[model samples]
Target: MSNADLPSHCDVLVVGAGPAGAACALWLARAGVDVVLVDQHDFPRDKVCGDGLIPDAHHALRRLGVYDEVMAAAEASRHVACIGPRGGRIDVPGTVAVLPRRELDDIVCRAAVRAGAKLRTPWRFEAAVVEGDVVVGARLKQGDVVRETRARWVVLATGAVPQALQAADMCKRRTPSGIALRGYVKNDAMVGRIKALEVVWHKSLTPGYGWIFPAPGGRFNIGVGIAHSHPARDGEPAKMKDVNLRKVFEAFCAHYEPARELMRTGTLEGDLKGAPLRCSLAGARYSRPGLLVTGEAAGSTYSFTGEGIGKAYETGLLAAETLLAAPGGVPAGTADDVRTRYEAALAALQPRFDLYERANRVNAHPWLADLLIWRARKSERLLRRMAGVLEETSNPGNLVSVRGIVRVLFPGA
Candidate 1:
């Protein structure tokens, strides 16, 4: 959308046109909510991510009515090749795919535009335009040119970055729940060899894991992540590790054979990139008067697997549905009612996030991967449950719990 064509007012002003914001804008626009979607960067921009789309992401794609389009542009996979701490590999079956965020985000965002949302790129969100105690819209900047948009409601779909949340007074935790580093690799030799979405856990990469998902066109997305920096129950302040991301990445390639082979034989497409993650719903508040937060900004990523695409999409849609429930009028209790309802909707997802947090034990203790993979190799029951975790039908915490260990050892005995 052109600057000349920009509207001074919209029904809902959505900040950060990533998955959450874009998906929310898409639903709102489709419902004829007169939503305006804003982003700091242009579409098809590179976003640092593993680029793997698990079952939850697929579920979101289908729900957004762009499943065929995404699949057509994606690298399809049938399972994940999970390598344990002791080098035990387990091929857990699931419908997975890989597409770089450059392509994936554009597809979803453009889908929103096609659904009639006004998408304004190169717009950086400055702060919310608050009247009294309620947010009425947002002030955005594009280079030196500033735009103030008035809206009945605002949705913060900004992913990971907390500056926008802080400006809006919605930030609860200034630090991210985790941080991830990744880079793309182009290699013909590694494509088929690295077909499945591969994740590795090792002692050297404690508090984290490494992933090398094969994207379409013979490119691989390789990265390592420090999954959980602070526990939900830990009252102490979260501290940054003294470790260098590059050195940790080097250790990943050195210890994991596939990564070593890919790094050694493949050409690096770009510089290694890093980004923070908000996980387990621990970073920011869900809602405020006249505003709602969605996506990674609302801590959409999971602590266990570091997946958030599907949840981002889901949360964005939920926000849209909430606003849709209250079509018009700022009655005395309307904004408060919306905030309460949005908080309740997001609260329902917290138990699942807590479950993922519990399952993050494997990141801190790699040996657990060995035990789980070993038992999974022996027990079909255990394997099915692991598969269920990928499909979001099983709790990851149960997979690593005492009862889970018993189930692994006995196997229906």
Candidate 2:
């Protein structure tokens, strides 16, 4: 659509029609709020991600009333197999699903539109329109024309795009926490052989891991992620910026016999893509006057596993709930109330974020991860507990506690 055709005002203007923005709009529109959801790209756009949905993501989809659709379109797996650095393997049974972002995102965004949210595509967010320290709306560029969208509130769900946050003066940190690369490969033989999601912790990829997730139609989503701030083994200065993620991923495939064999007969479906990740543990602010941030823009991605879909959906719901609960429409001074409530809701998730941060530290140590996997392999109780962690049914803190450590060390007890 042309910039001239865009709406001049709305009750809420949501930038980015991804999961977060879509969910927020879905809930708001369902509540009879006038919401405009905008994105640079249209439906069925691919996003660089592992594309695996854990149980938490399933719950989020259910809450959004789209779980049935996602499940019907996704590949369901009840097991997660992990290969530690020392080659020790552990398999935990749980509920997980994988669906390409192209389809998953389209489903959610369509739901938002069906629920009466206005969706504008190819709308590039340029900057926030502020008046006296309050964001009254946003300026957007479409093609050669620039347009302004006035709204009572604005939501920034633009994923990890730093320019938007930086322009709004909301970005708390300049450096990204980590980076990840992903691509799809078609291999019927490999897909048939691997019924469960697989994660490998190679010693070379400290503080990061590799994954193979089953996608629809005999395809696999393969990827690797590493912390940008991870230290070099020899104590030399880390040249993270100089590192080539593609080369690293190639090395990973070459080193792992299974991955190598799988890729040997498989054809690459697309060029490998990479993206930066910001973790919620970084403590980035989620809201400011007349504006709120959700998804990766708010640092909602988990620090340890790089799992953002579930958290993104969650923050979207919370943002919508906060706005819907306000007695009247948001006024200039009332922005603070919205900010306070959103921050408090985010605070409730801090424990999980802290646990994931601690787990990331454990992941850095190859031997520690190997030992834990080794023990879990021999004990059904421990295995079940580990599965619970993946399903998010059990607290991650239990796996790191002294008592929990003792139980794992002596499973017979």
* Best-performing candidate as measured by lDDT: 1
lDDT of 2 by residue, 59-174 (tens): 99999999999999999998888888878888788888899999999999999989998888788889999999889999988788788999999999988868888877788765
Indicate the TM-score of model 1.
0.96
Q: For each candidate, what is the lDDT?
A: 0.87, 0.83
Candidate 1 residue runs with Cα over 4 Å from true position: 1-5, 230-234, 327-333
lDDT of 1 by residue, 176-207 (tens): 88889999889998767878898999988888
Could you estimate the TM-score for every candidate? 0.96, 0.93
Backbone clashes counted, model 1: 0
Candidate 2: where are CA atoms >4 Å away? 1-4, 228-242, 281-283, 329-333, 397-406, 411-413
Q: lDDT of candidate 2 vs native?
A: 0.83
Model 1 scores a C-alpha lDDT of 0.87
